[model samples]
Target: MNMLKYPTLLTALCVSTMLLAQKAKPVKQGNKSHTDVATVEYLPEFTREVPAESGSVFKIKNKRYNLEIRLWDQKKVRIVSTVPMGSDTDTLTNDELYKMSGVTLSAFGKRIDLASDEYPENRVAEVTNIQVQGLPAQPAKNRQDANGAEEIVVEGYKTTTKKQQANVGEVTVVGYKKGGTDSSGKTPSAFPNRPVKDEPASIYGTQNPQVADVVVTGYKSTWTRTSSTRRNMVVYIPRDCKLVVDNRYTDIVVNEDLDKAEFTLYRSNLGLRNVNELRVDASFYTMYAGNLGYADLKLASGSLTAGTIDNAQIESTGSEVEYEGGNTLFLKSKADRINVENVGSVGGYKEFGELRIGKLSQDLTLEGKSTHVKIRQITSEVTAIRISTQFADLRLPLKQLTGYDIDFKGDNSTVYSSFEKKEMNANAGIANSESLVAAGVTFGNKAPAAFHVKSDESAGKKTSFNITCNNCTVDFK
Candidate 1:
């Protein structure tokens, strides 16, 4: 064989072997080449323009993918994706890829920000002002239903009629009729009549000469008497009227706001779907409300349970008040137990009672005399906490007091926390035999004071706690 022919055959064999090796290699999962070749299709699901004064939110969604672009305070633009992630490229659709790898370019006035998780240096595209459509107008009341059904409009109080049956009695009478002969045609009488009596005793008494069984026809009539009965009707309150509930021995139930004010009191249930303000003053009764825009309540000896009140001014004397949720609460009471949970900005004063707050979203100002207070969770928005009590034991779970400035003043009262003894300042001028002060123990700061407790790094905003007690011991962890 020629040497050139052998060289050409060897070169061809080496090239074929390289191609076979490449084909035998396994492909890695989630490769871009594995994605479906079809282009992504987007359909408009819904567009919502949030009602706000300073900020605006425009949302666009398609199927299971949602892209929300929010302009907060006209200064920042946030693009959020609510689509779930897929395991591999084959499982992920084009919509998912658009959400995961898309960039958001928004401009407000002359300021613009480009935000994206992928391709940070990509060219920015100019965008025009987005035109947002307002919500659809609601139909008027008493209008026909959307499903082509006739709506029955009922106004005023409902009426019900009832009837009563009449009474009846029965009686029997006896009478006689005689058979007569012809008068002038030589007719004789069958039997001659003896006598007829006109007095009552002859008809009903003894010594009767003749007796005969007579058939008497008597008429008996039946009559019906009807009487109308009406129930106690409810008084409809106007929508704009402020609800003033003042009653004794009556329990009131307040349902959700149906753009009206509806209340059930005693035996009457009235609905006024337009009331926005509520004021209640009742004693020896109980009131329950679902939600109120604004409320002013005063109770001498009763209980009030409410779901949420936007703003409230509450006063109670020897009564229980339970507020499940609210924004602002201004409370003043004496000798009563008050429990409020999930509230923001609470300022109150209590005397000779117990107060328990589950969670606070903002600030808290409390001043009490001889009262027990317990707070479960205080958020980062709380800047300062001040408590002044006399002759009462104050217990606060130390876990809730992380990164707070604690100041306590009391006479013959005890203050205790979950912090250890070595984690407190305890070096103030009041740290004598009679007074124990735990102060200047800064948490989350680089330079710590004497006996400083280092809170968890993940704690929220730093707060200051100034507590004052009389004749008491202060302890912290």
Candidate 2:
């Protein structure tokens, strides 16, 4: 960023004055009118001073003219011509010299600000206040783009200003904002960019109309079911979505538009096997429902919030399973741990039973209507567990869950387990939620003796069940 120098304006005017004088002169053809001009010659001459020389040399039309001229620090003007009509030598008349030097330094001085040079700053006037003084009343004749690439020249002045305000830093910006509309705008948006499929609404009053599309915003998600289970429900988790995973566990987010969400489930010799570890990764998927109902809903790295409507039930069987979507998801029996990384506005219903999680690292949130959630064995390090309710109790093995920091947020809930009864001194806190003890010890605020649990080895190595409450309470018997 450089400043403007006013002296340069004078130098430019010297050339402009000469041009003006040439334009004013009319042509006198042999037998033609004044408009019948033939041609005009513009000869620019420069006089150079040879140091230690008696005088100087003038270069005119590539020819040298020996003459005497004085310069003040190479910034002086000199002119001498043999043509008496346009000469500006000492012997020439005032009118002749003035006409020869048609431009005065003052004229050029007024426009020196436009020069890209370093000099006195703040020379360029505010373009808004300064109008094009010498412009013609009407605009110049319009010019069309011959090759369709329209280009127009814009001429204007620029200025700089500064304002100081309290508590805020000084803001400096260049002001060149004023101009006509753009000659070329961007192309319009395409028509009906794509297609969307229509899905029928559920008639059971427990399900809403199926959504053909699901868009994920930020890739953080939570799959929460509440404290109740009026009946068994199935939620289909899809597979065509993004998955973010670390060492402990993986996250699933099904945020994409699909024509349909369907799956087939296979029944194992047993139910969901607690013997083998399982991992869940989702994108888009179909499921196979064996004897038990399965939900073919895809869980991405987003909030897949669902609650039991009537008595819907859904749980994945630990058997040979395969699913298909835009992208195939191979959710093998290697790991099956779930967590709610973050929460957003989620709308839907999800139900699960016979919980079998291989690992649990992040925070897990469970809430819904008469929903049943059971995590048989959390064989991995636990971060935090939060349980809430329309009506339901979270059941898990206490010995398998170990972490220095464990947070329990539940409401009117109960925890039942059969992994190990050994009590360890672990810091536990509760919030506004109530707690119930059925078959094992419960961790939360309000604890009642009616929910006490008696551990039995016949319940198995990793056997657990939970009775979350909605509007009703039941017994373990």
Off by over 4 Å in 2: 1-358, 403-446, 449-477
Residue 109 displacement in candidate 2 (angstroms): 60
Write down the RMSD of candidate 1 (Cα, Å). Answer: 35.5
- Candidate 1 lDDT, 310-331, residue by residue in tens: 8888887888888786888888
Q: Write the per-residue lDDT of candidate 2 for residues 248-366, one digit (tens) a residue.
A: 11111222222222211111011121111122333222222221122333333221222111112223222223211111111211112322212221123334322223333333445
TM-score of each: 0.41, 0.21
lDDT of 1: 0.41
TM-score, candidate number 1: 0.41
The C-alpha stretches of model 1 lying farther than 4 A from their native spots are: 1-231, 237-275, 400-402, 418-460, 471-477
